[model samples]
Structure formats: C-alpha cells, structure tokens
Target: MNAFSLRRVGLALLAPAIAVVVSVIVTTIVIAAVGSSPGDFWSAMFSNPLPRIRVNVVNQTAMIYTSAVAAAIGFRMGLFNIGLEGQYLMASFAAASFAGAAYVGGFLNVGLSLLIAIAVGAAWAGIAGILRTTRGVSEVISTIMLNAIALTLVGYLVDRYGVHEGNTVRTTKIAAGDMVKGFTPYQARDGQVWALAIIAVLVGVGFWVLLNKTRFGFDLRASGQSESAALASGVNPKRMILVSMMLSGGVAGLIWMPALFGSAGSYGTSFQFGLGFLGIAVALLGRNSPIGMLFGAVLFAYLSAQSNTLTFSTDISPSIVQITQGVAVLAVVISYEVVRRWRARLEQRVVSRELAGAMGATA
Candidate 1:
C-alpha cells in the first residue's frame, strides 16, 4: 500500500488498540482490588496448557464470529438488528424440533434443518422490516418487542409440545448419526472441533464479498450513508432496509448451530442466551473489517477459555473478563466516535485549504 493507505489503516486500528489497552488496565485494577496477584492472573490467562481449551477457543470464536457477521450485515445498511437474540433462539428451537423429528436421515437432516433455521430467522426479522417499511415503525422498538414475544412464543411451544424426560422440557434429541461430524484440530488428543466452524468462515467471507465486491453492496452502503442520496441515485432505501434485516436474521440463525451440533444436541430452556447482545459489542469493536471481527472474537474466546481455568487454578475470578468486556465496549464506542470526528475535521481542513488556494489563484 501507499503512504496514505498505510496512514488510514493505522488510524483505523488506533481506536480498537486504545480500547484494548484501556480494558486491560481496568481489568488489572479490578483484579488487584479483588486481592488477586496481577502477575499470576496474566500467567494463568495466557498459558494454554490443555489442548481442549484451545479447541474450545476456536469453537467459541466460530460461534462469536457468526454472530458478529450477522450484526455487521444490518450495520452496513444502517439498521440496528437488536432482534438477533430472538431470531436465533426461535430459529434454533425450530431447527432442533425439525432435526429431532428425524423426517430424514444423515446429511439430509442437517441440510433441511439448516434451511429451516435460515428461513425462520429471516421470517422473524422480516416482521420488523415490514413494520418499518409499511407502518413507519422504528426497528429498535419493534425488535425489542419481538424479543419478548419470541421468548413467550418459544416457552409456550416447549411447554405444550416439548418432550419431557424429567422436570425439564426440551425438543427431541437429534440422533448421533445425524449430528454434524467434528474433526481433530491439529490432531490434538481429545480435541474434536465442530465441522460447522467451516460454515462460520464461509459466512464471514460471504459477508465481506457482499459488502465490498458487489453492486448490491455499493447500493446498500450508499443507502446506509445517506438515504436521500441513495434515492436520488435510484436505489430503493426501503427495499434495502428490508433485505438487510432479513439477511442479517438469516445469518443470526446459524449462531447457535455450532453449539447445537457440537454439544447442546437439543434446544432447551438452558440454551445459550445474550449472544445477540454480545454480537453488538463485537461488531462495534471490530466495526471496520471482517478480519477485525475475527480478532475481536478470538480475543474474547481466549479470555473465556483461559479465565475459566484461572478460577479453578488460582484465587482469581473468571468474571473479571466480563468486567473487562463491559469496559472495552464502552471504550471502543467512545474512541471510534472520537476518531470519526477527528477524521471529519482533518478532511474539512484539507477542503478549506484547497478552496482558499483556488480562490486566491482565481483572484
């Protein structure tokens, strides 16, 4: 890259780097206040002795990356898809019910279930989009309300039709043969990484291409940056909004698949929650690029795997990572906005200088 390109890249990286440093400082402070040795904490956090933890980190990264990509889709179109939590929960439940029904066998089961998930997620998110495009409803409000409705709807479905083995009610269990097969990463002992992780990588690549390498991407981005300009350019902003939401929801549908195929086996009351919200933070921190999102996912995943070990190996609290994450999100948000404003000012100065010189020469 040229000098200007390198400068822009550095500027893009500065905010996330600052956020990470601040989060680290804040996390160390919390650890110190909790009477833990910072040295021991750092040592325990980075020393990945068990191959299993490393595999878990990779698996977790795959899941988190999926969530980030889903969130990023709506973000690119200036839509805040807060309904991701509801969309994924509803999708996973539907997929579990379908796959567990054993209407088909082997690869067909996985394929059909995947389609069901993507469709359900898109349809669920489409509700908000339709409301927005036709009724002038704000997506933020509709999505939040939809989340509540999804929770209630899923609860009712589970209570009425869910298979009960004991006190718990869940969808029927997927057969062992129908489950997605895992492979041994680096041929590690006792490490079987989920095959769905490959799908996650594909999602990221597709997202990148969709945003950067297509006419639809250009129009979507134009619509995102300025609806009026996009309209003047003959791009339908409403259609873009609806499509973006559905697309985001479709990807959100896959967020739970890794966990489902990896270990969860069935959708239950204890299925993972807060992933949608987590995606928002990841998207914000890694706002600029898909690769940045990967780094963010890996960072959080490493903390997750390593910190859990710390709780058992030492007196340090694993929840410290949560504190750090919370702080990091806030820092990232502030830092990025600041950087944006700074860039705008610098651009303004350049434009102003050029205009002044042009006026002088004309005179």
Candidate 2:
C-alpha cells in the first residue's frame, strides 16, 4: 500500500485502541468511586470458566460487528443509517416467521430464511434511499423517521401474523434446525454457536473487497467524497446513493439473525432497541474500515461481557458499562480528529520538503 493508505490504516487502528484505553481508565475510576477494587474487577472480568465467558464474548462480538458493518456501509457512502435496530427487528421477525411456517434442514432452511431477511431489509432501507434520490430529502432525517415506521410496521406484522398463540407482542419461536450455530466453537447451555458470528466476519472481509476492489465500490466512494465531481465523471450518483443505503440495511438485517435464529427465537417490541445507535458509535470508532470495525466490535463486546461479570463480583452498577461505552466513543471521536490533523500536517511537511528539493535542483 502507498504511504497514504498505510496512514489511513494506522489511524483506523489507533482510534479503537484509544477508545479502549480511555474506557478502561474511566471504568477504573467508576469502580473506585463505587468502593470496589479495580484489581478484583479486572480479575473477575478475565478469570472464568474460559469457555462460558468466550460464548458471551462471541455473542456480543457478532451483534456489534453486524451493527458496525451496517453503519460503516452507509457512512462510506456519506449516508447515515439510523434505522438498523428497526431493520434488524423486521428482518428477524421475517426470518422467524418463515422458519415457523415450515420445517427444513438445520442449515438449509436457516440459510434461505436469512437470505429472505436480507432482501427484506434492503427493500426497507431502499425506501429512504429512494426518498433522498428522488425527493431531495436528507437521509439522516429520512432514515430516522423510517426507523419508527419500521418498528410499528413490524410490530403489527408480528402481532397479526407471526406471534405465538399466547404471546401479546413476540413472534413464535424458530425451530431448532433454523437457529444459527457454531459461532464461537465453544460449548454453551444451548450447545449452539452463533453461526451468524462466523458469517459476520466473512461479511467484513467481503465489505473490504466491496469497498476497495470493485468498480461499484469506487463509485460509492467517489460519490461520498464529491457527489458533483462523481456525477460529472459519469457516475450515477443517485443510483449509488440508493444502492448504498440498501446495502447498509442488508447488513443491519444480519445483526438480527443471531437473536432471532440463535436464541430469542422470536421478535418482539422490546427486541428492537439500542442496536441502531450502538451501530453509529461502532462506525465512528471503526472509521468506516471493515477490519477496523471488526476490532471495534470485538472490543465493545469484551467490555459488554466483562460488565456483567464485574457486576456480579462487585458493588459497581451495570450502568457503569453504559458510561464506559459513551466515554469510549467520545474519546475515539476526539482522538480521530486529532490524529487526522496530525497526519495532514505530516503530509504537508513531506510535500514542502519535496518542493524545496525541486527548487534547489532548478537553481
């Protein structure tokens, strides 16, 4: 890679690391304030029936990574997808509904249902994309509004067509064969691994290729960087914008696969919350890079998993986890800006030195 590319990668890595360190520091302070020993908290966080802890880690990792990927896809195209939670809910409900309607093989049926969920999510997101492209609406506003619409629409669907006989809000449980498994290679109470977790990593790799190696990816980036320039250069900026939003929504749908297919077995009103906003934070921490996003997701997962253990072993409230997450995101944002400025100054210096050398040779 060129120096510029390497620098970008470095910044991406640095942002998440800075966030993690800041979160640790903030968490330590909170522990002290709560009259808990930070050392004990740390011990509880790390020492465990390693397999069980790993399972929780894998679950959170999968969820966060899927959400992060959804946000990153939109961020790359200069669109903010704030409807991931609703999209996830809708897709999960669709998947569960399909699974409940028919019994099939373990992997085959689940795979097909997931495919349908992705398509549904894409279509849902495409609505906002179309609005922005044809009606000149802001995607930020459109997506936010669409989130509410999706929640209401999916809630009604679950109640009317998908819910179990006795349940007031939740859909029916997906069959055993339809749940995602083998996500972490660790044994759990359910004996199921989050197959979606493995899928999330593959999706991350696919995203890397999509954003950096493909012509479509180039067009998306160009439009994000400069819409008018991309339009002048023969790119269909409107189409790209619409397509990017759909892709973002599709990724969001993946987040729900684990919840719907792996454990929850159903969709409910309470099932759709916080994930969309968390996705925005993950995207910022990842700086729109797929690999970086994976790391950020893993870190967030670790923190989240640790929080529960910490609560059990100490006087610290579970709310401390939220505080840490918020501080981490804020720290990462500020650090990213600072690092970007520094890199820009370094590039300027390099260019200035080259120009001086050229002038001296001319003289």
Candidate 3:
C-alpha cells in the first residue's frame, strides 16, 4: 500500500485503540469504587479469558461478524436499515417452517432452506425499501414498525404450528442426516462447532470484494458519501436505496443460520435475539471494514465470554460489560473526529511535499 493507504489504515485503527484504552481505565475505576480489586479482575481477564478461546466464542464471533456485515452494507450506502431484527427473524421462521414441513433430505435440503431464508429476509426489507424510494419515508421509522410486525407474526405462527413438547416450544427438528456437519477439530467443551463458519468467512471476503471491486458497490457508496455528487455523476439515488436495502437484508438472512443450523436444527422461542442491533454497534466500532468488523466482533465476544468468569470470581458486577460497551462506542465516536482531522492534515502535507518536489525539478 502507498503512504496514503497506510495512513488511512492507521486512522481506522486509532479510534478503536483509543476506545479500548478509555474503556479499560473507566471500568477499572468503577470496579475499584465497587470494593473489588480492579487489578486482580483485570489480571484474570487479560491473563486468560478461557484456557484458550473456546469454540463457542468462535461460533458467536462468526455469527456477530455476519450480523455486522449485514449492517455494514447499509452503512456503506448511508442507509440505516434498522429492520435487520425483523428481517433475520422472519427469515429464520420461514426457513424453520419450510425445512420442517418438507420431506427433502441431506445437504440439498439445507441449501434450499438457506435460500429460503435469504429470499424471505430480502423480501421483508424490500417493503421498507419500496416505501422509502417511492414515498420518501424514513427507513428508520419503517424498519422499527416492521420489527414489531415481524415479531408478532413469528409469535403467532410459532404458537400455532411449532412443536410443543411439554412446556417447551420449538420448531420440529429436521432429519438427523440433514444437520450441517460440524468441524470436530475446533469443537470446544461444548463439542458444537458451527460448520457454517466457513460460510461466514466467505461472506466477509465477499463483502470486502463487493464494496471495493464492484461498480454497484461504487455507486452505492457514492450515493452514501454525497447524494448530490452521485446525482451529478449520473447515479440513480432511488435505485441505490432499493438495491442496497435488499442486499443488506439478504445477507442478514444468514445471521441466524449459524445458530439454527449449528445448534437448534430448528427455530424456537429460545432462539438468540438482539444480534441485529448489536451488529449496528459492531459496524460502528469497525468503521464498516470487513477485517475491522472481524476484530471488533471477536473483541466483543471475548469481553462477553470473560464477563461470566468475572461474575463468578469477583465482587464486580457482570453488567459492567454493558457499561464498557457503551463507553467504548462513545469513545470511538469522539476519537473518530480527531483521527479524521489528523488524516486530512497528513494528506495535505503529502500533497505539499509532492508539489515542492515537482517545482524543484522544473527549476
């Protein structure tokens, strides 16, 4: 990479670095005030969150990474598609219902089920997109309302047709043979490794390539950076909005797959929630870079996994993690502005140096 690219990368890392340092300092003070040995707590976490990073952490990171990428798609386009919660849940419900109701068998069944999920998620988000493009409604409002509708629908259907054994409620399990194969090598104490981990990695790579290497991605980003400039460049803002929203939701459909295919084999009342919103935080922390999001998701998963150990061993509250997360995000937001100005100065210096060199050569 050139100096500008290297500097840009540094700018990207600066905010998260500052946020981590600030969060640690604040969290330590809070722990000390709470009558806990802040030094001991920090030592325990930094020494080892686990004997080693567990498979569960890896799986959770992958899931979160997918969620972050879904949100990043919208971020890149300057559209906040807050309806990821609705899109993924509806997709999971549709996937579970279709997979259980069908008699199809094997990997083919799994593939089809996943396709159903992507389509359902995209279609749900499409509603919001259509409204935004045609009626100029704010996506934030439409998506929030859609989340309520999606949840209500899921609740009703699960109650009506979901398998209810005793008091527990879950979707009917697919055939045992149909479960996606797990990576036994990476299995933690839980012995459940999400086979879809490969899929998550692919998604990250694809996301990076799409945004950096494709024309549509360029148009989407252009519209995001400046709608007026994009319009002057002959880009259609309406189409960008619609396409980016659908793309965001389509990727979001896969967020639940790791949990569903890797563990549940079906959707249930007990399925994981709030990841969609968590993804927004991840996207912000990572500044929408796929690699950056990977590290951000892993850091989040690590902190969360470590919190359980902290709760058991220290007087400090586990809810401290929430405070840390909030503070870290706030720190990053503030630090980003500082880094932005720093980068602009660096770029100006480089331009001035190059201009001086050209003048000297001519003289």
**Model number with the top lDDT:** 1
Q: Report lDDT per candidate.
A: 0.87, 0.78, 0.85
What is the lDDT, from 0 to 100, of the residue 151 in candidate 2?
A: 74
Task: Tell me the spans in candidate 1 whose CA falls farther than 4 Å from its real position.
Answer: 1-9, 186-189, 344-363
Report how far off residue 139 is in candidate 3 (Å): 0.9
At residue 77, give the lDDT of candidate 1: 87
Query: lDDT tens digits, residues 8-50, model 1?
Result: 6877878878887888898888889988898888888878558
Best candidate, TM-score: 1
TM-score of 3: 0.90
Cα lDDT tens digits, model 2, 111-138, are 8888988988888898889999999999
TM-score of each candidate structure, all chains considered together? 0.91, 0.86, 0.90
Provide C-alpha RMSD values for all models, in order.
2.7, 3.4, 2.8
Model 1 clash tally, residue pairs: 0
Backbone clashes under 3 angstroms, per model? 0, 3, 0
